[model samples]
Target: MSETIAPALLAPATSCGVFIIATPDRLAALQQLVAASGARLLGAVTPGNAAARLADQISLDLLLFDASSLAAGEAADVAIALAGSMAGRDCRIVTLLDVASIDAVAGPMFDAGATLLCNPSPTELAAALAGALAPGGTRLHDAAREREAERLRLLNEEVARLAEVLSQLAADPANGVRDRSSGYRGEPLAEPDPDPRAVRSTIRARRLRDQHFAPELFADPAWDMLLDLYAARLEGRRVSVSSLCIAAAVPPTTALRWIGTMHDAGLFGREPDPTDKRRAHITLTDRAAAAMRGYFRAAERAGLVPA
Candidate 1:
Protein backbone atom coordinates (compact mmCIF):
# COMPACT_ATOMS: atom_id res chain seq x y z
CA MET A 1 0.00 0.00 0.00
CA SER A 2 1.08 3.61 -0.67
CA GLU A 3 0.34 6.84 1.16
CA THR A 4 0.85 10.58 0.73
CA ILE A 5 0.43 13.75 2.73
CA ALA A 6 -2.91 15.32 1.89
CA PRO A 7 -2.81 18.32 -0.44
CA ALA A 8 -4.66 20.50 2.09
CA LEU A 9 -2.03 19.77 4.78
CA LEU A 10 0.96 20.17 2.49
CA ALA A 11 3.48 22.94 3.09
CA PRO A 12 3.78 26.09 1.03
CA ALA A 13 4.65 26.01 -2.69
CA THR A 14 8.26 26.83 -1.91
CA SER A 15 8.63 23.58 0.01
CA CYS A 16 10.30 20.85 -2.01
CA GLY A 17 8.00 18.23 -3.54
CA VAL A 18 9.35 14.76 -2.83
CA PHE A 19 8.53 11.34 -4.22
CA ILE A 20 9.85 8.15 -2.68
CA ILE A 21 10.42 4.54 -3.71
CA ALA A 22 11.17 2.30 -0.76
CA THR A 23 9.96 -0.62 1.32
CA PRO A 24 7.17 -0.04 3.84
CA ASP A 25 9.61 0.05 6.75
CA ARG A 26 11.96 2.46 5.04
CA LEU A 27 9.03 4.61 3.92
CA ALA A 28 7.79 4.81 7.50
CA ALA A 29 11.23 5.90 8.70
CA LEU A 30 11.59 8.65 6.10
CA GLN A 31 8.11 10.17 6.46
CA GLN A 32 9.04 12.30 9.45
CA LEU A 33 12.32 13.34 7.87
CA VAL A 34 10.69 14.46 4.63
CA ALA A 35 8.22 16.56 6.55
CA ALA A 36 10.87 17.89 8.91
CA SER A 37 13.06 18.96 6.01
CA GLY A 38 10.17 21.20 4.88
CA ALA A 39 9.83 18.91 1.88
CA ARG A 40 6.25 18.01 1.10
CA LEU A 41 5.69 14.33 0.61
CA LEU A 42 4.08 14.13 -2.81
CA GLY A 43 3.83 10.32 -2.86
CA ALA A 44 5.38 7.09 -1.68
CA VAL A 45 5.43 3.78 -3.58
CA THR A 46 7.08 0.40 -3.40
CA PRO A 47 9.71 -0.65 -5.89
CA GLY A 48 7.22 -2.60 -7.95
CA ASN A 49 5.07 0.49 -8.53
CA ALA A 50 7.89 3.00 -8.85
CA ALA A 51 7.52 3.52 -12.58
CA ALA A 52 3.75 3.84 -12.49
CA ARG A 53 3.84 6.22 -9.53
CA LEU A 54 6.55 8.34 -11.13
CA ALA A 55 4.59 8.64 -14.36
CA ASP A 56 1.53 9.99 -12.56
CA GLN A 57 3.43 12.88 -10.96
CA ILE A 58 3.59 15.96 -13.18
CA SER A 59 6.59 17.46 -11.43
CA LEU A 60 8.95 16.69 -8.56
CA ASP A 61 11.72 18.48 -6.70
CA LEU A 62 13.35 15.45 -5.08
CA LEU A 63 13.31 11.67 -5.46
CA LEU A 64 14.28 9.61 -2.41
CA PHE A 65 14.95 6.07 -3.58
CA ASP A 66 15.95 3.35 -1.12
CA ALA A 67 17.66 0.36 -2.71
CA SER A 68 19.27 -1.15 0.37
CA SER A 69 16.77 -4.01 0.51
CA LEU A 70 16.55 -4.48 -3.24
CA ALA A 71 18.23 -6.96 -5.55
CA ALA A 72 20.74 -5.65 -8.06
CA GLY A 73 18.42 -5.84 -11.10
CA GLU A 74 15.54 -4.07 -9.38
CA ALA A 75 17.90 -1.44 -8.03
CA ALA A 76 19.27 -0.84 -11.51
CA ASP A 77 15.72 -0.27 -12.80
CA VAL A 78 15.14 2.36 -10.10
CA ALA A 79 18.41 4.09 -11.01
CA ILE A 80 17.44 4.11 -14.68
CA ALA A 81 14.05 5.60 -13.83
CA LEU A 82 15.71 8.27 -11.72
CA ALA A 83 18.00 9.33 -14.55
CA GLY A 84 15.24 9.29 -17.16
CA SER A 85 12.70 11.25 -15.12
CA MET A 86 15.05 14.06 -14.13
CA ALA A 87 17.07 14.29 -17.33
CA GLY A 88 16.84 18.07 -17.85
CA ARG A 89 15.48 19.21 -14.55
CA ASP A 90 16.88 20.34 -11.20
CA CYS A 91 15.39 17.47 -9.25
CA ARG A 92 17.70 16.16 -6.51
CA ILE A 93 17.93 12.37 -6.25
CA VAL A 94 19.19 10.66 -3.11
CA THR A 95 19.55 6.88 -3.25
CA LEU A 96 20.28 4.56 -0.35
CA LEU A 97 22.16 1.43 -1.33
CA ASP A 98 23.73 -1.46 0.53
CA VAL A 99 27.11 -3.00 -0.17
CA ALA A 100 25.68 -5.86 -2.20
CA SER A 101 23.64 -3.66 -4.55
CA ILE A 102 26.19 -0.86 -4.89
CA ASP A 103 28.13 -2.33 -7.81
CA ALA A 104 24.97 -2.70 -9.84
CA VAL A 105 23.56 0.80 -9.38
CA ALA A 106 26.50 3.04 -8.48
CA GLY A 107 27.53 3.79 -12.06
CA PRO A 108 24.08 4.87 -13.23
CA MET A 109 23.30 6.78 -10.01
CA PHE A 110 26.60 8.67 -10.31
CA ASP A 111 25.94 9.51 -13.96
CA ALA A 112 22.51 10.83 -12.94
CA GLY A 113 24.15 13.07 -10.32
CA ALA A 114 22.29 11.41 -7.46
CA THR A 115 23.80 11.52 -3.96
CA LEU A 116 24.57 7.87 -3.16
CA LEU A 117 24.67 6.72 0.47
CA CYS A 118 25.73 3.18 1.22
CA ASN A 119 24.11 1.68 4.31
CA PRO A 120 23.82 5.05 5.97
CA SER A 121 22.89 5.41 9.62
CA PRO A 122 20.01 7.64 10.72
CA THR A 123 22.41 10.50 11.43
CA GLU A 124 24.08 10.22 8.05
CA LEU A 125 20.71 10.09 6.31
CA ALA A 126 19.51 13.20 8.11
CA ALA A 127 22.68 15.06 7.21
CA ALA A 128 22.31 14.13 3.55
CA LEU A 129 18.66 15.21 3.51
CA ALA A 130 19.51 18.52 5.14
CA GLY A 131 22.30 19.17 2.64
CA ALA A 132 20.11 18.32 -0.34
CA LEU A 133 17.32 20.58 0.91
CA ALA A 134 19.78 23.48 1.49
CA PRO A 135 18.62 26.95 2.60
CA GLY A 136 15.01 25.92 3.19
CA GLY A 137 15.90 22.62 4.80
CA THR A 138 15.93 22.16 8.55
CA ARG A 139 19.37 22.53 10.09
CA LEU A 140 20.90 19.85 12.30
CA HIS A 141 22.56 22.36 14.63
CA ASP A 142 25.75 20.39 14.82
CA ALA A 143 29.39 20.68 13.79
CA ALA A 144 29.45 17.55 11.60
CA ARG A 145 29.10 19.50 8.39
CA GLU A 146 31.76 21.95 9.42
CA ARG A 147 34.11 19.15 10.34
CA GLU A 148 33.60 17.49 6.97
CA ALA A 149 34.35 20.76 5.18
CA GLU A 150 37.55 21.19 7.21
CA ARG A 151 38.63 17.63 6.41
CA LEU A 152 38.02 18.12 2.72
CA ARG A 153 39.94 21.39 2.81
CA LEU A 154 42.90 19.64 4.42
CA LEU A 155 42.68 16.85 1.82
CA ASN A 156 42.79 19.33 -1.05
CA GLU A 157 45.78 21.12 0.45
CA GLU A 158 47.71 17.87 0.74
CA VAL A 159 46.86 16.94 -2.85
CA ALA A 160 47.96 20.33 -4.13
CA ARG A 161 51.29 20.13 -2.26
CA LEU A 162 52.01 16.66 -3.63
CA ALA A 163 51.02 17.66 -7.14
CA GLU A 164 53.31 20.68 -7.05
CA VAL A 165 56.29 18.63 -5.92
CA LEU A 166 55.62 15.89 -8.51
CA SER A 167 55.14 18.43 -11.30
CA GLN A 168 58.53 19.95 -10.54
CA LEU A 169 60.16 16.56 -10.51
CA ALA A 170 58.54 15.62 -13.82
CA ALA A 171 59.36 18.92 -15.49
CA ASP A 172 63.04 18.94 -14.54
CA PRO A 173 64.22 15.44 -13.77
CA ALA A 174 67.92 16.41 -13.81
CA ASN A 175 67.56 19.43 -11.53
CA GLY A 176 68.02 18.00 -8.02
CA VAL A 177 67.66 20.49 -5.20
CA ARG A 178 70.60 20.12 -2.80
CA ASP A 179 69.38 21.02 0.68
CA ARG A 180 72.76 21.62 2.34
CA SER A 181 71.05 22.60 5.59
CA SER A 182 69.46 19.12 5.87
CA GLY A 183 72.33 17.22 4.22
CA TYR A 184 69.90 15.96 1.54
CA ARG A 185 71.29 15.73 -2.02
CA GLY A 186 69.53 13.30 -4.35
CA GLU A 187 68.17 13.75 -7.86
CA PRO A 188 65.05 11.76 -8.84
CA LEU A 189 66.13 9.47 -11.68
CA ALA A 190 63.84 9.28 -14.68
CA GLU A 191 63.59 5.54 -14.39
CA PRO A 192 61.10 3.20 -16.06
CA ASP A 193 57.72 2.84 -14.39
CA PRO A 194 57.88 1.12 -10.99
CA ASP A 195 56.90 -2.55 -11.01
CA PRO A 196 53.27 -3.33 -10.15
CA ARG A 197 54.53 -5.75 -7.50
CA ALA A 198 56.32 -2.90 -5.77
CA VAL A 199 53.09 -0.92 -5.63
CA ARG A 200 51.16 -3.92 -4.32
CA SER A 201 53.80 -4.50 -1.67
CA THR A 202 53.47 -0.94 -0.46
CA ILE A 203 49.70 -1.30 -0.17
CA ARG A 204 50.16 -4.50 1.82
CA ALA A 205 52.60 -2.81 4.17
CA ARG A 206 50.10 -0.05 4.94
CA ARG A 207 47.42 -2.59 5.75
CA LEU A 208 49.84 -4.62 7.85
CA ARG A 209 50.54 -1.60 10.05
CA ASP A 210 46.87 -1.40 10.95
CA GLN A 211 47.23 -4.84 12.56
CA HIS A 212 49.66 -3.49 15.17
CA PHE A 213 48.46 0.08 15.67
CA ALA A 214 45.30 2.15 15.50
CA PRO A 215 44.07 2.17 11.90
CA GLU A 216 42.79 5.69 12.33
CA LEU A 217 46.35 6.86 12.88
CA PHE A 218 47.04 6.31 9.19
CA ALA A 219 43.59 6.94 7.79
CA ASP A 220 44.24 8.55 4.44
CA PRO A 221 41.66 7.26 1.98
CA ALA A 222 42.76 9.53 -0.85
CA TRP A 223 46.35 8.31 -0.85
CA ASP A 224 45.35 4.69 -0.26
CA MET A 225 42.97 4.75 -3.24
CA LEU A 226 45.52 6.44 -5.45
CA LEU A 227 48.01 3.70 -4.73
CA ASP A 228 45.40 1.00 -5.35
CA LEU A 229 44.39 2.46 -8.70
CA TYR A 230 48.00 2.99 -9.70
CA ALA A 231 48.75 -0.67 -9.08
CA ALA A 232 45.65 -1.73 -11.01
CA ARG A 233 46.64 0.49 -13.90
CA LEU A 234 50.07 -1.04 -14.05
CA GLU A 235 48.59 -4.53 -13.98
CA GLY A 236 45.92 -3.72 -16.61
CA ARG A 237 43.14 -4.72 -14.20
CA ARG A 238 39.75 -3.04 -14.02
CA VAL A 239 38.72 -1.84 -10.52
CA SER A 240 35.05 -1.86 -9.62
CA VAL A 241 33.49 0.79 -7.41
CA SER A 242 33.10 -1.70 -4.56
CA SER A 243 36.72 -2.83 -4.91
CA LEU A 244 37.95 0.73 -4.69
CA CYS A 245 35.82 1.29 -1.60
CA ILE A 246 37.54 -1.67 0.07
CA ALA A 247 40.91 -0.31 -0.93
CA ALA A 248 39.96 3.02 0.69
CA ALA A 249 39.76 1.30 4.10
CA VAL A 250 36.89 3.48 5.27
CA PRO A 251 33.15 3.32 5.60
CA PRO A 252 31.36 2.71 2.31
CA THR A 253 29.57 6.07 2.43
CA THR A 254 32.80 7.95 3.06
CA ALA A 255 34.53 6.07 0.26
CA LEU A 256 31.75 6.89 -2.17
CA ARG A 257 31.93 10.55 -1.21
CA TRP A 258 35.70 10.59 -1.66
CA ILE A 259 35.34 8.86 -5.03
CA GLY A 260 32.88 11.54 -6.12
CA THR A 261 35.14 14.29 -4.81
CA MET A 262 38.18 12.84 -6.54
CA HIS A 263 36.23 12.52 -9.76
CA ASP A 264 35.17 16.16 -9.56
CA ALA A 265 38.78 17.15 -8.83
CA GLY A 266 39.93 15.37 -12.02
CA LEU A 267 42.08 12.97 -10.01
CA PHE A 268 39.84 10.07 -10.95
CA GLY A 269 37.91 8.98 -14.06
CA ARG A 270 35.16 6.44 -14.66
CA GLU A 271 35.10 3.94 -17.49
CA PRO A 272 31.98 1.99 -18.39
CA ASP A 273 32.49 -1.72 -18.43
CA PRO A 274 32.23 -3.08 -21.98
CA THR A 275 30.89 -6.45 -20.87
CA ASP A 276 28.54 -5.12 -18.22
CA LYS A 277 26.41 -2.09 -18.95
CA ARG A 278 25.31 -1.88 -15.31
CA ARG A 279 28.87 -1.61 -13.99
CA ALA A 280 31.74 0.88 -14.18
CA HIS A 281 35.42 0.93 -13.31
CA ILE A 282 37.41 3.64 -11.50
CA THR A 283 40.85 4.68 -12.75
CA LEU A 284 43.39 7.35 -11.94
CA THR A 285 43.40 10.21 -14.45
CA ASP A 286 46.40 10.75 -16.71
CA ARG A 287 47.52 13.65 -14.55
CA ALA A 288 47.22 11.60 -11.35
CA ALA A 289 49.07 8.70 -12.97
CA ALA A 290 51.93 11.00 -13.94
CA ALA A 291 52.16 12.22 -10.35
CA MET A 292 52.26 8.64 -9.10
CA ARG A 293 55.05 7.78 -11.55
CA GLY A 294 57.05 10.80 -10.45
CA TYR A 295 56.60 9.83 -6.80
CA PHE A 296 57.86 6.30 -7.43
CA ARG A 297 60.85 7.53 -9.44
CA ALA A 298 61.76 9.98 -6.70
CA ALA A 299 61.45 7.27 -4.06
CA GLU A 300 63.74 4.94 -6.02
CA ARG A 301 66.33 7.68 -6.63
CA ALA A 302 66.46 8.58 -2.94
CA GLY A 303 67.14 4.90 -2.03
CA LEU A 304 63.79 4.66 -0.22
CA VAL A 305 61.43 1.81 -1.07
CA PRO A 306 57.99 2.84 -2.33
CA ALA A 307 55.57 3.35 0.57
Candidate 2:
Protein backbone atom coordinates (compact mmCIF):
# COMPACT_ATOMS: atom_id res chain seq x y z
CA MET A 1 0.00 0.00 0.00
CA SER A 2 1.24 3.50 -0.76
CA GLU A 3 -0.25 4.61 2.54
CA THR A 4 0.31 2.80 5.83
CA ILE A 5 -2.42 0.55 7.25
CA ALA A 6 -1.70 1.72 10.76
CA PRO A 7 -1.28 5.47 10.46
CA ALA A 8 1.61 7.33 12.06
CA LEU A 9 0.28 9.18 15.11
CA LEU A 10 0.11 12.94 14.70
CA ALA A 11 -0.76 14.99 17.74
CA PRO A 12 -4.28 16.37 18.27
CA ALA A 13 -5.72 18.92 15.80
CA THR A 14 -3.39 21.82 14.90
CA SER A 15 -2.23 23.64 11.78
CA CYS A 16 0.79 22.41 9.79
CA GLY A 17 3.58 25.00 9.26
CA VAL A 18 4.28 26.18 5.73
CA PHE A 19 7.87 26.31 4.42
CA ILE A 20 7.89 28.85 1.58
CA ILE A 21 11.12 29.04 -0.49
CA ALA A 22 13.03 26.67 1.84
CA THR A 23 16.84 26.72 1.85
CA PRO A 24 18.85 23.45 2.10
CA ASP A 25 19.50 24.14 5.77
CA ARG A 26 15.77 24.69 6.38
CA LEU A 27 14.89 21.47 4.54
CA ALA A 28 17.34 19.47 6.69
CA ALA A 29 15.93 20.95 9.89
CA LEU A 30 12.35 20.17 8.83
CA GLN A 31 13.24 16.61 7.84
CA GLN A 32 14.77 16.06 11.25
CA LEU A 33 11.66 17.51 12.87
CA VAL A 34 9.43 15.23 10.74
CA ALA A 35 11.39 12.12 11.73
CA ALA A 36 11.35 13.06 15.41
CA SER A 37 7.59 13.47 15.75
CA GLY A 38 6.58 11.09 12.92
CA ALA A 39 4.76 13.94 11.19
CA ARG A 40 4.86 14.69 7.50
CA LEU A 41 6.80 18.03 7.11
CA LEU A 42 4.51 18.87 4.16
CA GLY A 43 5.79 20.90 1.22
CA ALA A 44 8.91 23.09 0.81
CA VAL A 45 7.74 25.66 -1.69
CA THR A 46 10.37 27.49 -3.76
CA PRO A 47 10.03 31.25 -4.37
CA GLY A 48 7.20 32.44 -6.64
CA ASN A 49 5.70 29.91 -9.12
CA ALA A 50 8.51 27.29 -8.78
CA ALA A 51 7.05 25.97 -5.48
CA ALA A 52 4.27 24.21 -7.37
CA ARG A 53 6.74 21.73 -8.94
CA LEU A 54 8.16 20.68 -5.53
CA ALA A 55 4.69 20.43 -3.99
CA ASP A 56 3.43 18.19 -6.81
CA GLN A 57 6.43 15.83 -6.48
CA ILE A 58 6.30 15.56 -2.69
CA SER A 59 3.03 14.97 -0.81
CA LEU A 60 4.14 16.80 2.33
CA ASP A 61 1.87 17.71 5.26
CA LEU A 62 3.08 21.24 6.10
CA LEU A 63 4.90 24.30 4.79
CA LEU A 64 7.37 26.85 6.23
CA PHE A 65 8.34 30.35 5.14
CA ASP A 66 12.02 31.35 5.31
CA ALA A 67 11.87 35.14 5.89
CA SER A 68 15.49 35.43 7.01
CA SER A 69 16.54 36.39 3.47
CA LEU A 70 13.34 37.47 1.69
CA ALA A 71 11.54 40.84 1.48
CA ALA A 72 8.12 41.02 3.23
CA GLY A 73 6.24 41.35 -0.09
CA GLU A 74 8.19 38.44 -1.65
CA ALA A 75 7.49 36.10 1.30
CA ALA A 76 3.80 37.04 1.49
CA ASP A 77 3.26 36.51 -2.25
CA VAL A 78 4.76 33.01 -2.16
CA ALA A 79 2.61 32.09 0.88
CA ILE A 80 -0.55 33.20 -0.93
CA ALA A 81 0.24 31.06 -4.01
CA LEU A 82 1.09 28.05 -1.83
CA ALA A 83 -2.21 28.45 -0.02
CA GLY A 84 -4.00 28.59 -3.35
CA SER A 85 -2.47 25.25 -4.37
CA MET A 86 -3.45 23.54 -1.14
CA ALA A 87 -6.53 25.69 -0.69
CA GLY A 88 -8.53 23.25 1.44
CA ARG A 89 -5.60 22.03 3.57
CA ASP A 90 -5.15 23.23 7.17
CA CYS A 91 -1.71 24.78 6.71
CA ARG A 92 0.25 26.72 9.33
CA ILE A 93 2.71 29.25 7.90
CA VAL A 94 5.55 30.03 10.32
CA THR A 95 8.12 32.65 9.24
CA LEU A 96 11.68 31.76 10.39
CA LEU A 97 13.74 34.89 11.09
CA ASP A 98 15.03 37.17 13.90
CA VAL A 99 12.35 39.11 15.87
CA ALA A 100 12.86 42.16 13.58
CA SER A 101 11.00 40.43 10.71
CA ILE A 102 7.71 40.14 12.70
CA ASP A 103 6.36 43.38 11.25
CA ALA A 104 8.04 42.73 7.91
CA VAL A 105 6.84 39.12 7.16
CA ALA A 106 4.59 37.43 9.78
CA GLY A 107 1.32 39.40 9.53
CA PRO A 108 1.01 39.47 5.75
CA MET A 109 1.88 35.70 5.53
CA PHE A 110 -0.83 34.84 8.10
CA ASP A 111 -3.36 37.06 6.34
CA ALA A 112 -2.69 35.06 3.15
CA GLY A 113 -3.91 31.76 4.73
CA ALA A 114 -0.98 30.53 6.79
CA THR A 115 -0.64 29.94 10.57
CA LEU A 116 2.19 31.63 12.49
CA LEU A 117 4.29 29.70 15.02
CA CYS A 118 6.87 31.88 16.79
CA ASN A 119 10.34 30.28 16.80
CA PRO A 120 9.22 26.60 17.04
CA SER A 121 11.77 23.89 17.93
CA PRO A 122 12.04 20.67 15.88
CA THR A 123 9.73 18.66 18.23
CA GLU A 124 7.09 21.37 18.39
CA LEU A 125 7.22 21.80 14.60
CA ALA A 126 6.79 18.09 13.99
CA ALA A 127 3.86 17.86 16.44
CA ALA A 128 2.19 20.80 14.77
CA LEU A 129 2.43 19.22 11.29
CA ALA A 130 1.19 15.79 12.45
CA GLY A 131 -1.84 17.22 14.19
CA ALA A 132 -2.70 19.21 11.09
CA LEU A 133 -2.35 16.32 8.61
CA ALA A 134 -3.91 13.44 10.55
CA PRO A 135 -6.47 11.81 8.28
CA GLY A 136 -10.16 12.35 8.73
CA GLY A 137 -12.71 9.80 7.41
CA THR A 138 -12.74 11.08 3.82
CA ARG A 139 -9.01 10.68 3.09
CA LEU A 140 -8.81 7.16 4.56
CA HIS A 141 -11.92 6.03 2.64
CA ASP A 142 -10.60 7.49 -0.63
CA ALA A 143 -7.30 5.66 -0.15
CA ALA A 144 -9.15 2.38 0.53
CA ARG A 145 -11.36 2.82 -2.54
CA GLU A 146 -8.30 3.37 -4.74
CA ARG A 147 -6.65 0.18 -3.43
CA GLU A 148 -9.76 -1.94 -4.12
CA ALA A 149 -10.15 -0.47 -7.61
CA GLU A 150 -6.57 -1.45 -8.48
CA ARG A 151 -7.10 -5.01 -7.17
CA LEU A 152 -10.33 -5.51 -9.15
CA ARG A 153 -8.71 -4.28 -12.36
CA LEU A 154 -5.97 -6.91 -12.10
CA LEU A 155 -8.43 -9.69 -11.22
CA ASN A 156 -10.65 -8.81 -14.18
CA GLU A 157 -7.74 -9.03 -16.65
CA GLU A 158 -6.70 -12.43 -15.32
CA VAL A 159 -10.25 -13.81 -15.62
CA ALA A 160 -10.63 -12.45 -19.14
CA ARG A 161 -7.37 -14.12 -20.24
CA LEU A 162 -8.52 -17.47 -18.87
CA ALA A 163 -11.83 -17.11 -20.66
CA GLU A 164 -10.08 -16.30 -23.94
CA VAL A 165 -7.83 -19.38 -23.72
CA LEU A 166 -10.81 -21.62 -22.97
CA SER A 167 -12.78 -20.14 -25.89
CA GLN A 168 -9.95 -21.09 -28.28
CA LEU A 169 -10.55 -24.69 -27.22
CA ALA A 170 -13.91 -26.69 -27.56
CA ALA A 171 -14.06 -25.40 -31.16
CA ASP A 172 -14.40 -21.90 -29.66
CA PRO A 173 -17.87 -22.61 -28.17
CA ALA A 174 -18.96 -19.88 -25.77
CA ASN A 175 -19.71 -22.42 -23.01
CA GLY A 176 -17.97 -24.80 -20.59
CA VAL A 177 -14.82 -24.38 -18.47
CA ARG A 178 -12.72 -26.37 -20.95
CA ASP A 179 -9.16 -27.46 -20.38
CA ARG A 180 -7.27 -26.12 -23.42
CA SER A 181 -4.23 -28.38 -22.94
CA SER A 182 -6.20 -31.58 -22.39
CA GLY A 183 -6.17 -34.49 -24.97
CA TYR A 184 -2.87 -33.27 -26.45
CA ARG A 185 0.92 -34.13 -26.29
CA GLY A 186 0.55 -37.77 -27.45
CA GLU A 187 -2.18 -38.91 -25.01
CA PRO A 188 -3.97 -42.25 -25.43
CA LEU A 189 -7.43 -42.41 -27.09
CA ALA A 190 -9.58 -43.95 -24.31
CA GLU A 191 -11.58 -47.26 -24.45
CA PRO A 192 -15.32 -48.18 -24.47
CA ASP A 193 -17.73 -47.79 -21.51
CA PRO A 194 -18.55 -50.69 -19.19
CA ASP A 195 -22.08 -51.76 -18.01
CA PRO A 196 -23.23 -50.38 -14.65
CA ARG A 197 -22.60 -52.65 -11.66
CA ALA A 198 -22.00 -52.48 -7.87
CA VAL A 199 -18.38 -51.64 -8.78
CA ARG A 200 -19.74 -48.61 -10.62
CA SER A 201 -19.76 -46.23 -7.69
CA THR A 202 -20.71 -42.58 -8.31
CA ILE A 203 -17.94 -39.97 -8.35
CA ARG A 204 -19.40 -38.70 -5.08
CA ALA A 205 -18.27 -41.90 -3.33
CA ARG A 206 -14.67 -41.15 -4.35
CA ARG A 207 -14.82 -37.62 -2.91
CA LEU A 208 -13.54 -37.01 0.61
CA ARG A 209 -15.64 -35.36 3.30
CA ASP A 210 -13.20 -34.42 6.06
CA GLN A 211 -11.39 -37.64 7.15
CA HIS A 212 -14.37 -39.80 6.16
CA PHE A 213 -14.86 -41.36 2.69
CA ALA A 214 -18.01 -40.48 0.70
CA PRO A 215 -19.40 -43.99 -0.11
CA GLU A 216 -19.28 -44.71 3.60
CA LEU A 217 -20.89 -41.29 4.34
CA PHE A 218 -24.53 -42.29 3.76
CA ALA A 219 -24.19 -45.31 6.04
CA ASP A 220 -25.28 -42.87 8.75
CA PRO A 221 -29.09 -42.53 8.63
CA ALA A 222 -28.83 -38.82 9.41
CA TRP A 223 -26.68 -38.20 6.31
CA ASP A 224 -28.95 -39.87 3.72
CA MET A 225 -32.02 -38.60 5.54
CA LEU A 226 -30.75 -35.02 5.46
CA LEU A 227 -29.92 -35.14 1.74
CA ASP A 228 -33.29 -36.57 0.65
CA LEU A 229 -35.15 -34.18 2.91
CA TYR A 230 -33.13 -31.20 1.72
CA ALA A 231 -33.92 -31.89 -1.95
CA ALA A 232 -37.61 -32.53 -1.20
CA ARG A 233 -38.07 -29.41 0.92
CA LEU A 234 -36.43 -27.29 -1.79
CA GLU A 235 -38.62 -28.79 -4.52
CA GLY A 236 -41.80 -28.52 -2.45
CA ARG A 237 -41.17 -24.89 -1.37
CA ARG A 238 -41.43 -25.96 2.26
CA VAL A 239 -38.15 -24.40 3.36
CA SER A 240 -37.98 -25.15 7.09
CA VAL A 241 -36.64 -27.75 9.55
CA SER A 242 -40.10 -29.29 10.08
CA SER A 243 -40.56 -29.64 6.32
CA LEU A 244 -37.18 -31.40 6.05
CA CYS A 245 -38.34 -34.10 8.50
CA ILE A 246 -41.62 -34.71 6.67
CA ALA A 247 -39.85 -34.78 3.29
CA ALA A 248 -37.28 -37.30 4.59
CA ALA A 249 -40.05 -39.55 6.09
CA VAL A 250 -38.38 -39.17 9.50
CA PRO A 251 -39.67 -38.19 12.93
CA PRO A 252 -39.50 -34.40 13.61
CA THR A 253 -37.83 -34.87 17.03
CA THR A 254 -35.05 -37.07 15.58
CA ALA A 255 -34.45 -34.82 12.55
CA LEU A 256 -34.27 -31.72 14.73
CA ARG A 257 -31.62 -33.31 16.98
CA TRP A 258 -29.42 -34.13 13.97
CA ILE A 259 -29.89 -30.65 12.51
CA GLY A 260 -28.94 -29.16 15.87
CA THR A 261 -25.74 -31.19 15.83
CA MET A 262 -24.88 -29.94 12.35
CA HIS A 263 -25.64 -26.36 13.30
CA ASP A 264 -23.41 -26.61 16.36
CA ALA A 265 -20.65 -27.92 14.09
CA GLY A 266 -20.83 -24.62 12.11
CA LEU A 267 -22.61 -26.15 9.13
CA PHE A 268 -25.61 -23.74 9.01
CA GLY A 269 -27.52 -20.92 10.61
CA ARG A 270 -31.21 -20.35 11.32
CA GLU A 271 -32.74 -17.27 9.71
CA PRO A 272 -36.37 -16.27 9.80
CA ASP A 273 -38.17 -16.34 6.46
CA PRO A 274 -38.29 -12.73 5.27
CA THR A 275 -41.98 -12.82 4.48
CA ASP A 276 -43.09 -15.25 7.19
CA LYS A 277 -42.59 -14.53 10.90
CA ARG A 278 -44.24 -17.83 11.87
CA ARG A 279 -41.47 -19.82 10.12
CA ALA A 280 -37.68 -19.91 10.11
CA HIS A 281 -35.18 -21.52 7.76
CA ILE A 282 -31.71 -22.99 7.86
CA THR A 283 -29.15 -21.84 5.29
CA LEU A 284 -25.88 -23.60 4.53
CA THR A 285 -22.75 -22.03 5.91
CA ASP A 286 -19.78 -21.80 3.47
CA ARG A 287 -18.40 -25.14 4.69
CA ALA A 288 -21.82 -26.66 4.07
CA ALA A 289 -21.73 -25.30 0.48
CA ALA A 290 -18.57 -27.35 -0.08
CA ALA A 291 -20.35 -30.43 1.27
CA MET A 292 -23.30 -29.85 -1.04
CA ARG A 293 -21.03 -29.31 -4.06
CA GLY A 294 -19.43 -32.71 -3.39
CA TYR A 295 -22.84 -34.36 -3.19
CA PHE A 296 -24.00 -32.74 -6.46
CA ARG A 297 -20.80 -33.75 -8.27
CA ALA A 298 -21.49 -37.37 -7.32
CA ALA A 299 -25.10 -37.13 -8.45
CA GLU A 300 -23.94 -35.66 -11.76
CA ARG A 301 -21.56 -38.59 -12.37
CA ALA A 302 -24.49 -41.03 -11.82
CA GLY A 303 -26.60 -39.03 -14.30
CA LEU A 304 -29.00 -37.84 -11.60
CA VAL A 305 -31.54 -35.24 -12.73
CA PRO A 306 -34.12 -33.24 -10.81
CA ALA A 307 -37.64 -34.79 -10.79
* TM-score of each candidate structure, all chains considered together: 0.81, 0.31
Question: How high is the lDDT of residue 265 in model 1?
Answer: 74
Query: Against the unseen true structure, what C-alpha lDDT does each candidate score?
Result: 0.79, 0.44
Clashes of 1: 0
- Which residue pairs clash within candidate 1? none
Q: In model 2, which runs have C-alpha deviations exceeding 4 angstroms?
A: 1-21, 40-45, 48-50, 54-60, 88-97, 134-307
lDDT of 1 at 303: 88
CA-only RMSD, every prediction: 6.8, 24.9
The sequence of per-residue lDDT tens digits that candidate 2 reaches over residues 161-258 is 53344334324333454457856654322221222221123313423332474433333324443354334333444345545444333333334434
lDDT score of residue 260 within candidate 2: 50
